[model samples]
Target: MRLERAVDDFVVQLASERGLSANTAKAYRSDLDALAAFAGGRGAHDTSDLDLELLRDWLWQDSRSGLAKSTIARRSAAARGLTAWLAREGHTTADAGARLRAPKADQHLPRVLTRSQVDGILDSLAALAATGDPVAVRDVALIELLYASALRVGELVGLDLGSLDRSRLTVRVTGKGSKDRVVPFGVPALRAIDEYLATARPKLAARNSAEETTAIFLGARGKRINSRTVYQLVASLLADLPGTGPAGPHALRHTAATHLLDGGADLRAVQELLGHASLGTTQLYTHVSAARLKDTYRVAHPRA
Candidate 1:
């Protein structure tokens, strides 16, 4: 019934029932632990003993300690989750703190690139592929698949050569929380992968200290390509093309999702491709789609 023991139970519940990522569990645990520590000196040693005023005092301490708004919101959520679980388990008679409020946080719009800009970027990569540099070919494939499939950088780089079905034009990638999904790319990505495997990979492998790496994408040293390298590569490529914003791998992801929605792809299908557990996460793209729609209407409609 102690505070720490309750956190342990909550973590187990999260892991067994909620399927939260380990990092996510750690974050929630930290929030709960801080609350436990805050309430430790007080008489509130367990869930039943805690009160709404105690919860408010904890949040006040967080504010005085200079936690960010987002952080405070998360802590508030942690408090609510704990109380909810306690009520469900019959430790508390009612969810007294359920009505408690959290701080209002700033919202930022996700930046996405135009489809034409993506085409231009891929065209530039195609030129690099024509140089007969197999790595350059692989680079083209990597960029193409990333934009085409809307893969997270981790999902893209974590891919193994064995998981790719070039005949089907699909690659199996494990997304966040180790959930697997099959993502398809275009023929251009296929051709790039082929060239990389046939020419560039062998050359890079021959230079390796070991036999070879199973990584579908290899570095200059013939090991699995890492996330940082992919991020840098995308940034450098976007730098050469003028007027792009924050050209990380995620920008490609946002661009792909936005373009899918723009091109009449169903929201549910795109959600599956993007590995979102909820359609609500996918629905954010609808806002992007609607804004584009309004812009198009303003230019084309004479209804004013």
Candidate 2:
């Protein structure tokens, strides 16, 4: 098959049969498009012309272009996935990217908020919620649930009223790959949610048609909230905090996981809570916790 058409088909399969998230499929599309472009420039016009060497050449080109190691690694993985799929589906006799390799991605510690900083953020949100504006109340509830449950922003925005189990103080969120898991929240989050449901959500929902009533979180126009909106909300919340990592909604998730580990939560349980498919994926929080502990000991210990 032609390279571009083949890539498009592969990405469609990722989104449809494989159930990859839109963001992931989009990334694959970008990476494969670059590969197709590079191959086209070399007079290699079809998937058949793609070989292991060409795949490695793509990685080499990206490295020479000053792409971050993580980005280059992702590109290689993307190519590998596509080529493997092509071979499995009978489009190719061999997986051209089977031997492709890229530098390991640098793992920077995720930003985590201190306990007092979390308390102060919640206090400020609570005070704003007291003003009785529906949006303000909703914002308070949103952040509370975000920090309490460590929900991905996509899961938070995709939530429907029916997803909540009020009696259990838990929410059923559909995470990446359309996997659903019930995540519990604390009393403070429950209180904030109660207030938002009682006073804010209804008010906001009333502004739109009845068809828009199912969403748990609403935008200013009373439609279901978007991930970009959540990013902005969390960014504003973390703007002044001392941090070097991203200030998006995942920062709250990282903070929640680190805090859980710090408070002696079991690692396997935390893996389940965070919806990580692999234990290794969730173990990054242990590193964050250890770093924090080392910093504390350095500051408090009398011995140099």
Candidate 2's displacement at residue 195, Å, is: 0.3
- lDDT string for model 2 (1-304, tens) is 9999999999998899878888888899999999999999988888899899888888899999999999999999999998999899888899888888899999999999999988988899888888898999999999999999999998999899999998999999988888889999999899888899999988888888757568899987788989999999889989998878999999999999999999999999999889999999999999999999999999999993
lDDT (Cα, 0-100) at 283 in candidate 2 = 95
lDDT of 2 at 69: 95
Clashing pairs in 1: none
TM-score of each: 0.79, 0.97
Per-residue lDDT over 1-304 for candidate 1, one digit per residue giving the tens place of the 0 to 100 score:
7878988898889877877766688999999999998898776887777788889998988889898888888999988999899889988898757986789755544667777788888898889878877678778878988987899998888898888998899999987777889988889778777877887877766667766678888877878888999999998877766543577898889889999988899999999999999999899989977877897899999992
Q: Which candidate has the highest lDDT of all?
A: 2
**Which regions in candidate 1 have their CA more than 4 angstroms from the true location?**
37-49, 60-70, 87-97, 103-107, 129-135, 205-212, 239-247, 296-304
All candidates: CA RMSD (Å): 3.6, 1.2
The number of clashing residue pairs in model 2 is: 0
